[model samples]
Target: MKINVEVDCTPEEARRAVGLPDLTPLHDKYVSMMMETMQGGVPPEMLETMMRSWAPMGEAGMAMWRKLFEGGAKS
Candidate 1:
């Protein structure tokens, strides 16, 4: 047997129902940092190094990123 239920709610409400933590502040900080990088207040290499350090697989993750971009460029 199967039951179907329909519920209408805003995104925030849905997120709360699923017990997801609110990420508004984190998102705001990320956007602000990206904007600073775009304005040259932060060097691209520094941002890349920071991101690479944060990746779980480090160099391997960066290699995958390079491959993805190279494939996109060829297409």
Candidate 2:
């Protein structure tokens, strides 16, 4: 037997499905700090370390980081 599924759920839904809460605010803060670091003219090595250190704890954090970087790259 084979099982198939179409995952069309938002992060919040996925989190809730497994009993989790929204973490957008936390991600937003990270992005804010990253942007600030850039705007404040922080060094590259320092910024990279800061980003890695501030990375979220799990999948949700990773997803947020990706989105943040994508957006940051564009602007």
Candidate 3:
């Protein structure tokens, strides 16, 4: 037996349908903090340490984050 069902919805609607907690607020706060950090609100060593802890994928994750910040800076 095979079944095919399609439900059209926006990403947010899909997330809600799946019972995912809304993280928009948390994401916004995180972005704001990141901006502050990039603008020198936090020291380099502390930022590195924090990134090490937050980026579970280790150096690769850090590199990805580095690319993101670098791109932002270029904008």
Best by TM-score: 3
Better of 1 and 3 by TM-score: 3
lDDT of 3 by residue, 1-75 (tens): 999999999999999999999999999999998787788756668877878898979899999877876697799
> How many clashes in each candidate?
0, 0, 0
Evaluate all candidate structures by whole-model CA lDDT and list the values in order: 0.77, 0.75, 0.85
lDDT (Cα, 0-100) at 71 in candidate 1 = 87
Clashing residue pairs, backbone N/CA/C < 3 A, model 1: none
lDDT of 1 at 36: 65
Candidate 1 least-lDDT 10 residues: 35-44
**Model 1 clash tally, residue pairs:** 0
Question: Following a full C-alpha superposition, what root-mean-square deviation does model 2 have from the true structure?
Answer: 6.6
Among all windows of 10 consecutive residues in model 3, the one with the lowest summed lDDT is 36-45
Model 2 C-alpha lDDT per residue in residues 16-42, reported as the tens digit of each score: 999987888999998798667778876
lDDT of 1 by residue, 1-75 (tens): 999999999989999999999999999999788666656665647757866876688788888856864584487
TM-score of each candidate structure, all chains considered together = 0.54, 0.51, 0.75
Candidate 1, superposed: residue stretches over 4 Å from native? 57-75
